[model samples]
Target: MSGQLYLGLDLGGTKIAAGVVSGSGKLFSLVRVATPAHGVRSDLRALFDAAQATLAAARIGWPKVKAVGVGVPGAVDPRTETVWAPNLPGWKSVPLRRLLERALGRPVFIEADRNVQAMAEAWLGAGKGASDLIFLTVGTGIGAGIISSGRVVSGSRRVGGAAGWIAVTDRWQPAFARLGSLEAQAAGPTMVRAARLALRTQKRGVLARLARADRKLTGETLVRAARQGDARARRILAEAGEHLGRGVASMVALLNPELVIIGGGLAEAGDWLLAPLRRAAKKWGQPLASRQVRIMRTRLGADIGVLGAARCAMLEMEREKKSNVDFPSNQAG
Candidate 1:
């Protein structure tokens, strides 16, 4: 057994996942629990319970954990150690780091979920060896993490990677004001909404039938339908991809990253989405920069968030060690 181990937690709206990760990015044991939909106190308890179960499953104790890192699905201000996640109600400006540290009796670090995913990619996934990279997560929501010159660009306000807010249209919808312009046009809900709106006028195709049949439509349903050769579903996906591609093109023009890795649930659309996205990027992106960039899907899959959290903890541990290193003092005459 290694002397050093880290606990990594991924806090999502529906579930909380915890894992005991080694220094080499290997996950020893993982545990998951349904996230409490209401009450901040209950959700926090659920998080700790899941962590305890994960540690027990790994046959480890809290004493073995060197540090803990959490990746949260919201805005996390590292300076303030606070979090503001819309999905988790009543979590506005919550002192997450202090709370976790108190509960676990160990040093704790909290970071934005997208940033952790990007960190994992830079350290061990598709973006490995790349100094300049962009990780775009297109799931139920849209967000991005930028790694420029081998360092994460967290921005002055720590919200630099909020790519969902990028405006892609000349006219703004009220929804765009809340969900961000790019996300309003391209995210999972947006895709389903577009399909539903299309079905309202034209009553044809599998998507239309599915929309009429199922009161609730999801991005997964659309992707599955597209795979089965549904024209409407394919069209909807392509439209969403074009919007995402435009956003990507803008990112490439501004950052000129060596690689852009797309992850998250919507990424499952695969070629149905990527084909149109690549075409749009070529058509709209800055000529030279777009041509030189390589965009690919994430390789880390479901473990990206947890692994990224572990990486953050490892980095924090290293920084503290370096800062505490002792240097021989020169004797004063």
Candidate 2:
């Protein structure tokens, strides 16, 4: 193995984190920069600059880095190096890999952000010892990554595990007919919306105090109230958990994964979310299938994306090595 370091970039909607990770999984230099909210070009420029700064801070030039791996918040085409990001507008077919490679003068690999997170968990986080696992991030949005047979499972177009968009309801009307979506019901913003609607009613509980603390309700506030034993907050969380559980049930039936790792800002609700979700999964999902899957909170915290990206880079490097040495070479006389 080469004694070179790897650079990992986690380009999220809110922030871009870059770090130099040694082969032994030691992160030497780390830095974070706020992602530009203006548009696609601005965000991409900011991300590339941050990567350059991180490399400089580590005192390691692009020549010393074996590979540059990036995790994006949306789907990426490995063939075209295009990113289809919904949150980031005007990013369709962006030549991200080529752009980064041109700037850093190194091999650049790009993968779905959720896939990177799952890889991180599988390599060094909650799913380390587990062979089959599902990673769920429930925050501004809900998404998933599946690890089966000790490999990350990416469907065609690298958009395999979109758990958030899975339809839960049958009604398909455009306005009040958002029936088949876990994101529509249980994501962070959705939880706040539900809480706000609940507040309009006569239900009185800890949420009232929380709402008073911040006029605009958020998932953090809802979880805080639920933790304080507020009835309204608990009720709101319980309802959302039920919906989330149903989604988990669906996951169990389809994937039969050994473990489900839940993360993101909203997952901090702890048992308030897990308990109800478990009950709901039991009621909706296949009993035998759900029995095999263990749902737990992520232990990786905010570093999962970077770790996952590093893992991805390492994996790609390994593949390149194997292809170079193991494959038979053709020669002409």
Q: Pick the candidate with the highest lDDT.
A: 1
Off by over 4 Å in 2: 56-59, 173-180, 196-218, 228-232, 324-333
Q: Candidate 1, TM-score vs. the true structure?
A: 0.89
Q: What digit string (tens of lDDT, one per residue) describes model 1 on residues 1-333?
A: 785899999887667889999988889999888889696888899999999999999999999999998988778775677898766778888898899999999889887888888998998899888888889988767888888888787776567788888888899799887789998899887888877787778778777666556666777778877887888889888988898899999999999999999988788889889888988987999999999999899999878888888888888777677774421010000
The lDDT of each candidate is 0.83, 0.78
RMSD of each: 5.5, 5.3
lDDT of 2 at 89: 60
Off by over 4 Å in 1: 196-216, 324-333
TM-score of each: 0.89, 0.85
Give the per-residue lDDT of model 2 (tens digit) for 101-173. 8878889888878788888887778788777888888776678888887767777667787787777777553
